[model samples]
Target chain A: MNLATKDIGQSLGRFVLTTLGVGMLLMVVMAMGGIYRGILEDATLLVNEIGTDLWIVQRDTRGPFAELSRVPPNLVHRALAVPGVKSSREFVFHTVQRERRGKPFRMAVLGLSWPSDKGDWIPLLAGRPLRQNHFEMIADASLKIGLGEKIQLGKETYTVVGVTHDMLASGGDGIGFFTTADAQAIQFDVPSEAVRLERSSRAARGTRFELAAKQPSLLEFANLPAAELPQIARPQVSAVMVSVLPGAEVQQVAKIISGWDDVSVFTRKGQRELLLEGTVEKVRRQIGLFRILLVVIAAVIMGLILYTMTLDKIHSIALLKLIGAPNSVILGMILQQALMLGALGYGIAFLAGRKLFPLFPKRVILADDDLLMLAGIVLAISVLASLMGIWKAMKVSPNEALA
Target chain B: MNTLPEANSTNSTNVSDEIACAIETKGVTKIYGSGNTEVVAMRDASMKVQRGEVVALLGPSGSGKSTFLTAVGLINPPTSGQVLIGGEMVLEGPVAHTNLRTFRRNHIGFVFQKSNLIPFLTAVENVQIAMELAGESRGAARRRALELMEYLGVADRASNLPSALSGGQQQRVAVARSLANRPSVILADEPTAALDGERGRQVMDLFAKVAHEQGAGVIVVTHDHRSLDVFDTIFEMEDGLMHRAKKP
Candidate 1:
């Protein structure tokens, strides 16, 4: 007795195909949400980890992820000397591209201020955290490095001590955790030939000085291996991670460090906010705008579709009216069709997403609240879209059925 | 002879009128537009139909046969007039004495030129929906729908979609639907226009059979002269006036 459903049943092929079209459109909308969530998750992954209370970076720079930042390694000692400062670790992070297994591989190397911090923070899937500082590493499972695997980095070979899952670098690249000294060595590593060339150039410059002429032995000092030289400045680190004592106000400690002109200090929360709002703000907005556009487009398409479906039933509607069908019955027909279309479309999007989302390089989190919100939105859009069709049906006069 | 114009509105039948009048209209006139675009579709059209009788409104296209049918069906109220169904007043001028939709559902039925069956529904559902909308229970409506289809001799095609049934079958199903609520008056406009002469006569005969057997006053608007013998009473229209015609 439900005329609309019975009508749809008569042309089920067309109905199914139309529902599938709506589903595909909704699937794109779902992808937009998933991609947006993925970007935010990837952006904040490292900020949530690390467990540091403050980040001390080069003056006027945002933390390392937002921009290039380098602070002297001694900044860690300065941070430790502050009252209520529990611990400080030198942070060194850089990306390394090396040929492995005859293919180019990119790895983000993060220096754990080891012996004090042995990467105990990483959620290991296998193996153990770093015990020795020099050449041991905790590799992200993304790096495809197995436990006990050894790979040459910089001037030394490192053994993979632990393998962790999903512990990616800020850029979403696989990360390898090493000691600060080992990381600095890898960052500043040079070939022996280049070292020879650089040493000779320095020696030649030293010989031109009047001090070198008065004491020619000074040139021999420059000729010694670069490591044994005394004139070179100490190696700098990307930043310093500082943690406060339990029950100590991190804001107060940060205010104390703010007095130092050489470095800018930020609480961990500030770092995350900067990365989200500054580093990935544009991408997030673009995805959000695209999501809005898609929802609007879906609504418009559904409106047109429902309107056309109403037009198809124009004669039948008039006939029903002539037979004394009330407005509620006619309205129910159109409204129910719209609701069915939207419900089926959303169902398709969820099923298709379960298979498709994983293929994306970035993680997609379909949160329960987000899914529920989208369902509500779909319901609203369905009702709004059906209004046009209902309006059209209402305009059909029963007299149209005569003659 | 109660012809039209002056004679049409002069007589009003009392409850004791013979044959038990099922539908009566007095001085029904329909006017559309004004001034330069002024047109009168039906003027002083009065009619009386009794139970167990089938009346045909015969006319050429644009002669207001359909206009009068629509007015009688309560779908398009006349610009001026009064209508009575089952010997009780139901409409005056453009105003209805009762809820027009509910009143029509219980007392009037309509069949159009091309069956006008809802395409999405099966033959039986098309019939059942009318009764269901009239407040019949689903099971009762369906059972009555099947019974009416059976009475109309299309019971075998009850489950088929409108498109699946033959043209003649679809029209029979339309008739079956009109009778689903057992309305006292049935109004049809060119109900056989889409059928061949033989099929047209058959459906016209079916209308007469429905009225005679069910004791409903039936009126059909048609220009087809081949089926004139099927109607118990006949009326012809020209311009915007109606006059009773002698049955063949």
Candidate 2:
């Protein structure tokens, strides 16, 4: 301890410079770690906040968070009838591109089943949830849209009613909620000309529209009626959310529902993991690779710093050895210096990561526990780096001091 | 720097003969390698210096003076021989009596041609560290270091680093550091070789006084003949052998 203190005091400038260099490396590591945490948090936001144990969705579809899972609305009734079902609500999801001030913003829009907070996942910070079924919207804080402001989606303009915080999808896109009917309208709304063209095409195909126009002529032809045209089913939904009775198991209910073979059922947790694996998995893998590269770079920098410091003091080490200083003292000195560098650098990096992270568009969540763990990692790497220099220092002979 | 007291013969001044034989070696041989490529750095070298005695080890280049010094210093073990310091059997045929580092710190002190002081430390701190290594309290080490510096006339330069000192002054500071732990024996390898003729002679005279007043053994390895008058005894090495020069 005494030797270490004196050595550090004597070379303050060099020590600070070396530690600063290490600090910069630490900063990058902290930022990457924070980004990883941020991704998980953002992806799990709605599911975690909603506090539901089971989710009912279409077979083989991860849905709303991962991919499209639109079950028929009637399934909600059957899910409620299942054993242990406390209650069930319908959740409608769509991806809407809204144009505000001539700029388009892609947002994940969830439609709340009214009159029940059980499935109304987000709690509004200001104002209230949808009282009216249609034309009302609750925007996420990150959506950058103010309450009372209107945004255009397809042919409809809906007024923003409330604001919610941290409610984001796995894609890190902003979230907004509205009534199921409005969401369906937004999903299926088309230009009037397109609607007219569809009707004209059906008429031109010699269907019901042609028979209506020649009704008087048909009457004149005595008792021969024009044939009726078949009706086309509107676009059907592919998934539903379900809540079960207080004592019943969702998996058991899901099994029964899935056995029907009309559709599949998924628990909320399963849906979440599936979403993460299917949609966010590629991004996570790429980020993981980049993080490993950053760690390698930090380790290399630590090794280089330790090596250079040892080289700078080669003569002193030789003289100390010649004077019969023990090998342990020399080794301890080098290792301690490396550890100190790591500690100081880790501290600097924690602050740097915290300060710079907020500016990034993606949420960067840095937890204290995570930072502490990263600090331990950095220290271990530094110790490993010091081994090279310490080994070299130990091998230095007192004979070199004779020179 | 204040001048050290001149060297004086201790026998005329009434010192006991029981204090004689501070350093002793018998048939010390150091070989560099084994088999067909072996080289003999020092062969069959033996010498002794009494307590409170100052001796000069004189030799030419490649004559094994350093090899003998290092062997006696317990750095490079001899291929064969015995060494005794302060009456303790320290070395016998590639073996040592105690841990080499502990033995060096407690019983032996070393001074080199360049002073070899740690440049980062002040002169006093540099001297104090030797005492610290010997397990002295920090306060005691500082106090003792100051006393040694005062004794060597370097007390005023205690705070100055080695770079700030003159060649002669640095040599004196090295002398103070050597005596910091009150070692039984002091070994100097060309300690004054880097200084001028006058400063070199002055350093040799100080070594002799330190021997007499401090009651410690002093051995100098040098090629300088100008300071010969200051040595009580002189041993010359030639071809890895030692021969005593007749005292004037």
User: Which number leads on DockQ?
Assistant: 1
Candidate 1's C-alpha runs over 4 A off are A97-104, A144-152, B1-18
Candidate 2 chain A, run of 10 with poorest lDDT = A221-230
> Across all candidates, what is each one's fraction of true contacts kept?
0.79, 0.23
lDDT per residue (tens digit) for residues B55-95 in model 1 = 98988878888778878888889999999999889889998
- Tens digit per residue, CA lDDT, model 2, A1-403: 2555566777889888878878988887788877887887887777777666567666666665677776767777877777777777677776767666777788987777765642245677876677787788899888888989887787788888888877887777888887776777788888888776765564555444557566635323222211132244434453566667677777777787777666666677887787677777877777778888988899988998898888877877877776667788788888888888888898888777778888877788889888878877897888999988998898887767767
**Model 1 Cα shift for residue B247 (angstroms):** 1.5
Q: What is the Cα-based TM-score of model 1?
A: 0.93
Q: After superposition, how far is residue A377 of candidate 1 from its true place, in Å?
A: 1.2
- By summed lDDT, the worst window of 10 consecutive residues in model 2 chain B runs over B3-12
Residue B153 in model 1: lDDT: 83
Best by TM-score: 1
